[model samples]
Target: MNTTPASSPPAPVAALVQMTSGIDPDANLAAIDRAMGEAAAGGASMAFLPEMSLLLDRDRARSAPHIAREADSPWPAALQALAQKHGLWLHSGSIPLLADDGERRVNRSHVIAADGSIRARYDKIHMFDVTLPSGENWTESSAYAGGEALTVVETPLGKMGLSVCYDLRFPELYRAMVDRGATLIAIPAAFTVSTGEAHWHVLMRARAIETGCHIVAAAQSGTHADGRETYGHSVAVDPWGIVLADAGCGAAAGDGGYRLSFAPVASAAVDRARQAIPLARSRANRRITL
Candidate 1:
């Protein structure tokens, strides 16, 4: 007879939102409100949104008016109100906010508790400064200053680590999150179609397998008003490197309209995966030659 104790508690349901946000914050907020309602109705305790959930305007001159300090931005307050109304925890993918310097902006993500209080915030550490083979060039550093520290917070879902798009390529960040006792990580992204098709799935699975943590990557999808096309495959991966759900890409996803997908996040799954492999212990004992 097989007799083994449960590793942890039962799983919680998480809702991942895939959006194609435009320049209008009001329209975007309306979409998010509807999604939050749906997420609550679907039994999701927490909802994870894609990067730039509030606004996604590439034109600096046009987006300038909308991007302001956190205190001045109405979007954050609206999101908090939505969370409170739905009685659901919210992982606001990323919002563009003017930095303290008042000249540059920061891609910031926030964790809002169920009661409408802000729990934690994380600025995207990595800037998208690459020139794609398709002749698409993005110099995020020119407008958005990179973050200096990592952020992790406690929630009903689990001890959560936060990161934004472009940060996914750096495995060291995920490793550090695991070292900090994070059982789940949220990587909100707005991936280009070309890059998403090539690396999104592999990186998502790799991060999950390496850290033994549930990975929820809410993403932006479809063509945006700014004339950029993003790959729309919002995905959730388990600690065992298994895909729990994937909101498909292209026209099937309403060309980046509102799409909500649900996934299970169980602490027991994390514990079981870590126990089976014990990578953390092995790494702890490894010699560093730097």
Candidate 2:
């Protein structure tokens, strides 16, 4: 079922959905449903959404009860149905789900097949537990547990790597995925306004250039119900560090609300980038004898 880029089609298009989810799940799903339809209609074979697509409530105590379980959660089933309806691969950026202890939660990512089945799942590894320079305190570890394993899965777009918001800060994870033959990496993020403005584009470009893989990032933009603001520049970058598509500004800036940006995730670009850079292979051949 797994195939390399050489064996796949030439231009495999992907859609990145930029959203501003509130505390309400039903309303958010409605928005996503509409975006999925638009992506499919636009001829995208796959769609990627941002982290916390379901809910973003500031009160941890109030948000605890809303966490869903994959085994029984309607969100997965709903997403599966959406993928099946659109006949497209769907990558959910991240969701807060009940963890092993049933008390703690995990930031989980999902890859849905065209037939409405979950193909792969990845829990977020990094926890955003720092106090920002703006005096905004966040302790994600207090509410969510870190995932243990790296996730790379076969898709129509070639080998795909999965990660969440805070995980983007770590380059080693992307390098590891590249070593595993990943040609595309998806990072679903709910990056804060302060940090996103400072480091979002640079980090994304760096990852793509270093790995020679396309970076598809869907982001949460604008202010949310929790009074927290997000820098909303959901972008798609090619392997050569070029931004193929961007959401520009928020929905208020004349961009359609919950709009999906379509971009070409071509295998030829990956092939050319790897051939030109060869960094992945170069690292493997490096020798250091002690």
Q: What is the C-alpha local distance difference test score of each model?
A: 0.92, 0.88
Residues 1-290 of candidate 1 have per-residue lDDT tens digits of: 76997666557999999898888888888889989999999999999999999899999999998889988888888999999999999999999999988878999999999999999999999999999998899999999999999899998889999999899999999999988999999999999999998999999999999999999999998889889999989999999999999998743434236899999998899999999999978877889953
TM-score of 1: 0.95
lDDT of 2 by residue, 27-115 (tens): 88888888998899999989999998988787888886677666757788888888998899999888888886787789999999899
Residue pairs clashing, model 2: none
Clashes of 2: 0
Give the poorly placed runs of model 2, Cα more than 4 Å off. 1-10, 252-257
Choose the strongest candidate by TM-score. 1
Which candidate tops lDDT? 1
Q: Tell me the alpha-carbon RMSD of every candidate.
A: 2.6, 4.5
| TM-scores for every predicted model | 0.95, 0.93
User: Worst ten-residue run, lDDT, model 2?
Assistant: 248-257
Candidate 1 stretches greater than 4 Å from native:
1-10, 251-256, 287-290
